[model samples]
Target: MYENCLKGHSALVTGSARRLGRAVALELARAGADVIIHCNSSKAEAEAVKKEAIALGVDATVLSADFSVDGGAEGLIEAAFEVAPDLNLLVNSASVFPSNRLAEVTLGDINSNVLVNAWAPFVLSRSFAARAKSGSIVNMLDSRITDFDHSHAAYHMSKHMLALLTRLSAMEFAPSVAVNGVAPGLVLPPVDMDAKGGAADAQYLAGMASGLPLKKHGEPEDVAKAVLFLLASSFITGQIIYVDGGRHIRGGE
Candidate 1:
């Protein structure tokens, strides 16, 4: 709702091709910031988002990166810097949500979860700090990190690691880069559910919302608003704003 709040800033938002990442990038663009959109395999989708951002009267571009590959995060940072030479904001939003219980989790699952969710964000944060005069980072996290999710053992663990990095990086990058996170809960449909009309998924979400204190789910825009707040704040750091519709206050997930 703020106007031209980020007039002089530029941002690179990973996974900006769709969903929550797209929302965050657009939110920043609406606030008057040039955006560098990043996606791994969604070039066409990313281009669409870039057009929308450009329509907001801000410079926008797209970059592709595979965070699961070696040196991928570094390559993303380098390529982004080449485009936005004065980049001052980073949104680490690219993530994979694979469902696997503890006994069912494979080494491949663990590595992928850690690489994309935690390791990639850390690498980008470090790289951003080394070059920026002043910046802010908003890591997309899960509210499940506060309690636990047995259904996604590896994914939960990786998000827990990301939450810790949010705090630690704020300290390490002190006075230069402010690190924060936005923990979302029951926001959007999962990838598999997105393509087809998810009647069953809608029913599941309706049932799940009953357990939450607010008795409702959230939207991608809610998480975007949280990211925008952290980006605009100069005094807030090392904190996570849970945009979970009060679900996090429940005893356990």
Candidate 2:
């Protein structure tokens, strides 16, 4: 359904190496949008995504950055424009999920989470709006932001901040730039886990699914579909699409 929907447009999907981010980028390419794949330390995987996008008949490139570094978003925005002068979509999908209870969370953990998950996306959205004639943004979030995750104190806090940022940027960038968010639950294994979908990770998700409304986990493509919907939308902004199979609304997801 998205074929030629985004023809002539361009996008940048941060952390578009091998997980949910990669799925989002590939979907954009399938819709005929040239894309810049952003990564922190997944160059080889990012390159593979770029090749996949290129195979889909759209321009693709990789831009890496250390999002924890101050002002890092500025360079990413610069490179996005350079790679695709008509860059119009920014997908803030790169994030770090650290497990730490509130009592045990360290200053560094808080700092890192806030910088990459919250600050980087905020800065990139601001800059993208400043330069683009018209475009859209999609920030990746966790469904737990609506409730809470005691085991992921810093991560949850940063996601809450990003949710607010999405609303603020949507209000601020109105009439020109559209800002939105996609919150996923039990979609992919954490970066620290066996990304190859090992037995342990599958068992964990299988167990996690038992508590969700759908009684099952979601796929990266689910979130990617939500992103594409938001991008194709013209009257939607300051909104969030949760790809958690009713988990966010039904509770116990």
Candidate 3:
């Protein structure tokens, strides 16, 4: 909505290869921000998104890092600064969601989920604060943080950790960097739910949305708009905008 509001900013959006991350990167580019798209192994997809962002009339590039590894987050931040030293915006949009109930969740599952979903974002945020003089950070969170997702116990725990990090980081980075989050519910189906060589079933998604208070699911644009809104503002900090069509209010499983 705020056209060219981020004209001079440079952004690094993790997991920008596809889905919501792709939407956020393109949206930022539309607002005139130079974008660096990051992906774990989807360099091809990231390159395509880069083309889209460049077509938006802003400088764009692609970077890759494995958040599952030890130095991945730190390395990614270093790489981002190498490309855009004036970088000022960071969006922690990459995450891994595993489907395992609490009773069935293994230590390995917890370790992997937390590494990518929580630990990496923390490392990235810390690295960003240390390098940038002033900027904004938005961590993508799940609306399910307020409730239990019995089928995604590991993922749920990781998001809750991230939610805490968002608030604490805001206070820590205050008066210089604004730290906030966007919690989305049912905006897109989980990657694991996708059928072989196809997207997730539309009918299944529609059925899922019927339980939400709005009785409908949201689009990527809805979440992107929230991210842009947070990035455009200098006053708002430590707040989480829910783009979940009020599903968070119901605290569904």
Query: Candidate 1: which stretches are off by over 4 Å?
Result: 192-195, 198-201
Pairs clashing within candidate 3: none
Q: How accurate locally is residue 214 in candidate 3, as Cα lDDT from 0 to 100?
A: 94
How do these models rank on TM-score, best leading?
A: 3, 1, 2
The estimated TM-scores of all candidates read 0.96, 0.95, 0.97
Q: Pick the candidate with the highest lDDT.
A: 3
User: Any runs in candidate 3 off by more than 4 Å, and if so which?
Assistant: 196-200
TM-score of 2: 0.95
C-alpha RMSD by candidate, in order: 1.5, 1.5, 1.4
User: Candidate 1: worst 10 consecutive residues by lDDT?
Assistant: 189-198
lDDT of 2 by residue, 43-68 (tens): 99999999999999999989999898
Score candidate 3 by lDDT.
0.94
Off by over 4 Å in 2: 194-196
Q: For residues 1-253, could you state the per-residue lDDT of candidate 3 as single tens digits?
A: 6899999999999999999999999999999999999999999999999999999999999999999988999999999999999999999999998799999989999999999999999999999998899999999998998878889999999999999999999999888999999999887777788544324456666888999989998989899999999999989999999999888899886
Q: What Cα-based lDDT does every candidate model obtain?
A: 0.91, 0.90, 0.94
lDDT of 2: 0.90
Candidate 1 C-alpha lDDT tens digits along 109-180: 999999999999999999999999989999999889878788889998999999999999999999989999
> In angstroms, what RMSD does candidate 2 have relative to the true structure?
1.5
